[model samples]
Target: MSEVKLVLSYKETIQSKLDERTKELIIHAKNASQNAHAPYSSFHVGAALLLSDGEIVAGANQENAAYPSGLCAERVALFKFGFDKRDRYLVKAAVAVPQIKGENLVPPCGACLQVFAEYRAMQSTPIEIVLVNGSGKVLIAPDIYTFLPFAFTNRSFKYFI
Candidate 1:
């Protein structure tokens, strides 16, 4: 067995100084957070996806009584994009921000990472991810594979097929 090393890469910058597209993403993402249904954790999250065609779709975390049933803002936004666009326009960028007062915006969860990986695989393109926080820092990753190095895909069952 050989040792494996992976380095995650992303850019960090101020929100106010971001480009027009990224700035628009943050605005819509923060707006979505305001509509989050997070009574359980009180940690509302929101996401905005910018399609290559210039359409933006926003989503907020939807919690359920059963914790496992709840979905993260990232997945919600991506899934909504899939439902609406099918395989048409590619997602050029996405931004995810939390609603908590003093917490830094973090990366997506394990499940979300997997879902994003699948989307990339299907689209045959990269989706830029922008992570925003309360501290005024924005982290931008060119693709989900940066953070989810060993993401599993439907190809995992290739042997059976």
Candidate 2:
């Protein structure tokens, strides 16, 4: 039997050496964390999306009593971008989560990754992702697939073609 392997790619960079635009996006995400409504988990999370038009949209996690009714910070930002500017492409995304002492970096959920994959498939371009730790360290992935190896993409339905 033959075996197939999936590989994930990412880059870890110092915050000071990051490009100006990346730094800006991370900053927005960090600030957005302050607006998170996570009374249950007390884990505030924020996400920022950079559109092709140079506009940055940010979102904070909003928790609800029903639990599942609430959405993640990444989804909130992505949905806002999709609704407001359906024609534009999402160039990059950054996430920031606050820890008890400081803060931590977390990856997007599976649902969010699926949504991102759809958008990336439509654009035929890569979407950069920035993950920042509580100490402000940054990890950069060139595309969503890096965070979701063996992901389900639109191409998976090619049988219909």
Best by TM-score: 2
The lDDT of each candidate is 0.79, 0.87
Give a tens-digit lDDT track for model 1, residues 51-158: 877888888889999878989988888899889877565565555554433446578888888988888877778888888875667888888888787778776678
In candidate 1, stretches whose alpha carbon ends up further than 4 angstroms from where it belongs are: 98-103, 159-161
In the order shown, the candidates' Cα RMSDs to the true structure are 2.0, 1.9
Candidate 2 positional error at 133, Å: 2.0
- Residue 103 in candidate 1, Cα distance off native in Å: 7.8
In lDDT terms, which candidate is top?
2
Model 1 whole-model lDDT (C-alpha atoms): 0.79
Q: Which tens-of-lDDT digit does each residue in 83-136 have in candidate 2?
A: 898878999999987462334457898999998898888898999999886677
